[model samples]
Target chain A: MMDDIKELIEEGKFYFLNQKYNEALQYLNKALEKDPANIEVLYTIGIIYESINNPDKALEYFKKVIKIDPQHEDAIIHIHSISENQ
Target chain B: MERFVVIGLGRFGQSVAINLAKLNKNVIAIDKDPQKVEEIADFVFQAAACDATDEKNLRDLGLKNADVGVVSVGEDISSSILITLTLKEMGVKKIISKALSQVQGKVLIKVGADRVIYPERDMGERLAKRLSSPQLFDLIELTESHGILELLAPESFVGKRLDQLELRKKYDVTVIAVKRNVPKLKDDGSTSFKESMILSPGPDFEILLGDIMIILGKSKGLDKIKKVK
Candidate 1:
């Protein structure tokens, strides 16, 4: 099950790098289902949403990452940047 | 109006002081060169030929009461740094310094400069952006990933209404304004162009060819529109 989750995350990252956001979200969602509290997957999903100009969804995922691990620096920075603009 | 003290009489410093004065701000222009001071004496609220690095000279000019101070002596990095430090010590609330390099910029920030500007570097970035995207007339960066763009209307978007284009839903951008160039006959009977602007046109408004759109959106969304054929 762990190997399957890692494979899903790798696939999602590949699609994300290629700018195929919807496909990336599909794989990332699968990884989330396997590990509900995966901070890496949640952060990656937030980045994908941000790239697609969906700030609300991006903020949601990044906030989720912060909730799971309050020490998440990247997530905290993202939230600060987005909220500052708003 | 904010009180501004501009040090150094170089082109950059002179422009800053003159423009600030033109905006109705109380600007005190200072430099060591008497000729430079004389040239801008008529423009600013006060003009003086004094060493900006000397704390005594600056204190006599009441620099501590100025709301903002700009140190624009980039050619002489040492003098610029000293001036910046003097302004900070004199209780100036805001200090904007010009830096010749990244190292100087970091030093300025460490010495209490509120902002550091590299005119050459900034202009280079703007020129590169314009050269790469011919359609982009202007760009104002609001954040790292978002900005306001002025670009010519794409051929694909001609004759389409805002509602039909679905810009907000599809492209995730907003059209702030539209500028059209209209030809008018002068008194001597020669035709000249005049700009007509529409501020915040509604969804039913139609996009016309040759129109310039003022759009506000994330950089990704703007890039997507630029790629439209």
Candidate 2:
């Protein structure tokens, strides 16, 4: 199960780097379902949403990442950025 | 280090003295009010409660040897003029005076002030610009026609490569740098954001949302950029 989750994240990151945001979200969302508290998956999805200018959705994912891991500095920064823009 | 003699412990005078001292420069702050001088005594090299209009007192304080003298006697035109003349006659290298009006500024210049500043008017102008243009984060005026502006990346700029945007040809502006918050993986495996600056981004560089672009261009080009949604 852990291997599957890692593979899903790798696929998501690959698509993300290539600018295939929808494909990246699909893979990342699947990984998130498997491990709801996965920090990497949540952060990547937040990045995807932010890049696409879906700040509200991005904030949602980023907030979830922060709730799970308070030390997620990236998520905290994204939350602040999204809030300020709004 | 340059030595600065600041006369008049008004708000503007106090700020200049404190900032000069903070920069490790020698600052002598003078005011007629003992309370005002006492308030800034801890921050500057020397804070004295003395009448700045007295040339003898100024000469005694070695004002002639200072690199610069700033006269900021708020709302007291005669005192400001007297202080500027005193500093100039004492051979202060440069004299800056604050004025409440153009006429006062002109008089200060005629009385040997090297530069005249209108802090209140400048602050009001900045506030007006910020209120009118929400996208413009900050601006530094380089000349009457040119400036360096910090603004958010417009929506049309996002997802497009720098070369594709043709900003130089279209807007006559040069993108000097891009400020972004980039994600970083810490040694402990936690994720963090690092404030990064990309100086002189290449032609292939793509603009991302949330990026702050610092551009240098003429005022007309900057006004157009500000209007971009």
In order, the candidates keep a fraction of the true contacts of 0.00, 0.03
lDDT of 1 by residue, B1-229 (tens): 7899999889889999999988999999999999999999999999999888889999999877889999997599999999999899889999999998999999999998999999989878876876687577787889999999887888788779989989888779999999865433346432223558999989999876557889999999987887876
Residue B89 error for model 2, in Å? Answer: 1.8
Considering only N, C-alpha and C atoms within 3 Å, which residue pairs clash in candidate 2?
none
Candidate 2 lDDT tens digits, B1-229? 7899999988899999999999999999999999999999999999999988888888888878899999999999999999999888888999999999999999999999999999999888876876686567798999999999998889889889999989899899999999876654457543344568999999999987667899999999998988888
Q: Note the residue pairs that clash in candidate 1.
A: none
Every candidate's DockQ is 0.01, 0.10
Question: The CA-based lDDT of model 1 is what?
Answer: 0.84
lDDT of 2: 0.86
